[model samples]
Target: FGKNFLITTHYASLPWLDSLLQEAQEKSAEEHLMSRGIAFLLYTFLDTLVDSYFPVLDDIDEIIDDLEDVTVNSTSNDVQVRIFRIKRSLAQMRRVISPQVEVVNALVARTGKFIPAKMNPYFADVHDHLIRAFEVLDSYRDLMGGMLDVYLTTVSNRLNAVMKQLTIIATVFMPITFITGVFGQNFGHLPQVEHDNGYLFWIVLAFMGLITALQLWYFKKRGWL
Candidate 1:
């Protein structure tokens, strides 16, 4: 078997692939990999690539769990950013895994010059691994979507609660504001303003307090509180 094989990527680095290949090269002599021929080496390389996805999927699963809890319990922008980032990661994983599954399925179905009959089962195993990984990725995509929906619902509910409180406060203060404006007018000889011994001040205060209490009671009766 050759000591070197080409691994290409557009903008991503496969450091784990490099490490696995180097390890395989070191053990090639002991495993008699040369005698088994390059086909076995190729199988090993593909198997390593397929197996690498599991650990990454596991990490993503843990992240999804954490995000699920945070999304439900918290209303922070950071949670939203993390959810979108995880969603993007899942999309990228799907893009990479989907084509790989098709390619591996083709390899298993066709025994061409490059793939001998004896190696067909080995390639088929790789195909199975790819299919499993693809399924897991799709599940993660669904979970991420659910997480996003939950986050949005939680945020919306929180906003509605705040708005409800503000509306109640404004509603309760509306009559008091009107009473204040009516009594503050610059008219001469107003009915309440002409009272002796400042009784008008106490009367207006009592009247405003009574109206506020009535409004609060109505709100509570309607379950708006």
Candidate 2:
């Protein structure tokens, strides 16, 4: 008997992957499969599939790791959008692998035809690898959820800081506004109104200074400044 390999995938853009597959195909020795040709061929095929996932998983892990820095440092909304896009890509990969797993299981169950009794273990190994791949994807999904939470928290903190600063500015101006308003009013019979009083200016300056000092102290004490 002879073994023929046919690989069908949606990954048309990766030239290196195509080259790797082509090289493997050309370098594969039929002499190595002289005895258990069918079984080992299936093993080779499934092993390739299983091994391919590790590098992809590694790349995904690296990107996920970088997301923490991106969440903290990036000011552009594109980072969030890129995260969603990566998630969608991961979902697509998961979708593809799930069906492949089902297919492998079905092949394993219908063991009479293409896959013989001797090859069951090899197919089971494929199924195990597929399961591991899915588990990794599950972990990545959880990680994506965590990254989103971190992003939201960082954004909320920045917003709160801005609001706190604005509030402090408004608070500082409040007493100064009160002083200006009192001095601006036309109370003709008031005690300090008759003289061109520098004392009135002194009083206003003192009130403004006292208010500013008090606010600074309160803000410092509250650690909100």
Candidate 3:
């Protein structure tokens, strides 16, 4: 069974290696180089891989900066939504980056004939960078998470403040509403309905009540009540 599996794997690997060999041969033929020039060929392959990943790293860095901007400047719900979208994009970027880290690690782990010994350190450096990138991403994720929490708390606090202001306004108007409602009643038996000083008395009482409430509110605001 192992033999059969090995045979199948060998066959599968042949097409891929054949393609690599064909490309190497074409490039070598263009430069009129021999198969013994494996180091140059390996260098070309590794360089191409490194170059491809550099752009990915640059993109991730750009995304991190954008996310940082969103986290900093976000105020309204719309901005929060944008921040969340940035986070989603960062998450997707990490998904792509995480596998690339493995690819680098795999390259570093291999003692393959294709990989030159001197190039291993360079690959290891790249792998280290991948690790650092992941760490930075995690830190940024935590920062953004904290930022989101702060934003939510700020919004809630603002809402609470608004509610308190509205409540205080309602409380301030309660006595005025009560006085108006009582005076507006068309009851014929009311004593104030027939007295000349009755309107003035009610007006003075309403003013006094309003003044008392205002003084109380002012004292409360200043923490001096």
Candidate 4:
């Protein structure tokens, strides 16, 4: 029976179980050596995997901080380009981080086979860390949303300021245009049409009317009329 079981197990690649069995066989006086060896092997494997995963989570946190800085302090077209790059980086990070969460969850929900009963609490702790990482990611997403809103509002305010300046300029020049147009007419029976002083008189009157209209408009716009 032992020979047949060994033959059947040899057909599959269970390196972890093989290592445990080999170790138990090497120790001649061990009681329940196979089970003890397997338990130790599983604990060490989980420990190594969890240790490796933590560095990856730290890298993700660093990326989030860099993205937040770029999004919040950017003031040029370069900022838009940088924001797109950061978004892509975050997407890639999410892809990796989500699977890690699943892996931790699976470890926590293990039956009696892969993980020993004593190791369940350690895996549960890892699951808690993964949950915290997901929460941090959610908060970073919210901050990015707020930064985008502020950027749009800043652009809108600048546009409104430009429009207001143009409107004020147009208002200031409107009376000058009207005065010039009225004096340009070639009517034969006009009041100032027959004297040398007529041209001078019309020019002075037009200039005076333009100045008065401009002053009134300036006063109105400045709230001092």
Candidate 5:
């Protein structure tokens, strides 16, 4: 383009540019872009590139929606992994695209040999698309952050629930444990140890059962169960 001739090369296939090139080639003969010069073609190329990002953003939107629905019930590590991965992807996209937004805006503002004054509206349109992309990306970043918070909160709540259950079990066994400890003593004067008919054993068992039932009933009444 600097030598008044458009030279192009690609080490990797760019599907977006490929389609754009195809269309441009088909229009070259009829549209006579050669008469308007390479500036027009450059604008079209950049415009196509900018337009490709929308489809990707749309797909990200769908993924975010799905994640939000699953985030409430999902406790798997996969959800966290996906959230981080998408966040990194969005960050990379923002880094790469942000400068391009400015560049397009600059192109609209500055008229040069390659960028004509008459094409400001075209470049401005590209700028608008870039701004829209930025808005979507920023919103997705916020959503990803929110999803991460929700996942952590869910995990914390589950942990608290487990701890509560364990604590309740311990509480229910506390008096029973004390009763057994008292009977387990080696002292001969311990109640029920001097019994010859083994009636004391049944009494101790009944007492323990009674304590357990009472504790459970209290817990149920308090809505702790």
Candidate 6:
């Protein structure tokens, strides 16, 4: 197994793992990691695996930025979908990275003949890289949680705005609805009952228009719109 590299995984659909291996191979070509011995090669592979997390996390950070923008300007259902999607992605990353902490620690703890003394320090360095990956993953998880909270709050505020708008519209029309209802009555003793198309009707219409304009102006000045 000295010169042979075995690539085995149950997940054939994992393009990320393949990509990491490919990238590590490219870097190794430039730096010649093969001369660093077997244990060093192991460290290099693990370090590459850990380093791949950073670019993925960067992409996730970009998504969080987009989600935050959506939270402020819009409350579409897609925001909720994206929030959950980010959380799930973070969870998956943790699943992959967390156990590697233990794996790297075990590798550093080994004192067998297979692991040369000179490579112990290299394994320790890889262990540190795994620790940093775990820390960053946790940070990303917390960030995703905070974004979820902001998204929920934004949705709630949007709902309240819609309700408030409906309330305002109903309140502005209440008096006009009452006046019209009364004037539409079939009673014989009503004052404006016979004046269907006369001065009283025009006066009521002007009064309603004035009240509507005043309400709209008041709402605008209050910055409710």
Best by lDDT: 5
Taken over the whole model, the C-alpha lDDT of each candidate is 0.83, 0.78, 0.64, 0.62, 0.86, 0.77
> Could you give candidate 6's per-residue lDDT for residues 1-225 as a string of tens digits?
244453445645556566756765777555655655566667766776677778887888787777777877877888878888888988998898888888888878875755777777888887887787788778878987887788788889879989999999898999889888988887878876475568887898999899889988998999986
> What's model 4's TM-score?
0.62
Ranking by TM-score: 5, 1, 2, 6, 3, 4
Report the CA-based lDDT of candidate 6 relative to the real structure.
0.77
Model with the higher lDDT, candidate 4 or 6: 6
TM-score, predicted candidate 3 vs. hidden true structure:
0.65
Better of 2 and 5 by TM-score: 5
Among these predictions, the greatest TM-score belongs to: 5
Q: For residues 80-154, what per-residue lDDT tens digits would candidate 5 score against the true structure?
A: 999999999999999979999988888888988777789999889889999999998999999899899999999
Clash count for each candidate, listed in order shown: 0, 0, 0, 0, 0, 0
**Model 1, runs deviating above 4 Å:** 1-13, 28-30
Q: Candidate 3: misplaced stretches above 4 Å?
A: 1-74, 198-225
**How does residue 200 of candidate 3 score in lDDT?**
69
Which 10 consecutive residues of model 1 have the lowest summed lDDT?
Answer: 1-10
- Which pairs clash inside model 2? none
User: What TM-score against the true fold does each predicted structure earn?
Assistant: 0.88, 0.83, 0.65, 0.62, 0.92, 0.75
lDDT for 190 in candidate 4 is: 60
Compared with the true structure, what per-residue lDDT tens digits does model 2 show for residues 1-225? Answer: 234444456645655456555765566465444345565666666677677888999999998888778888764678788778778978998998989899888767776654678787778889989999999998898888788777778778888989999999999999899878877888767657578556878877897999899999999998987
79-169: candidate 1 lDDT, tens digit per residue: 9999889989989988988898888777778765556679889989999999889889888888888888888999999999999999999
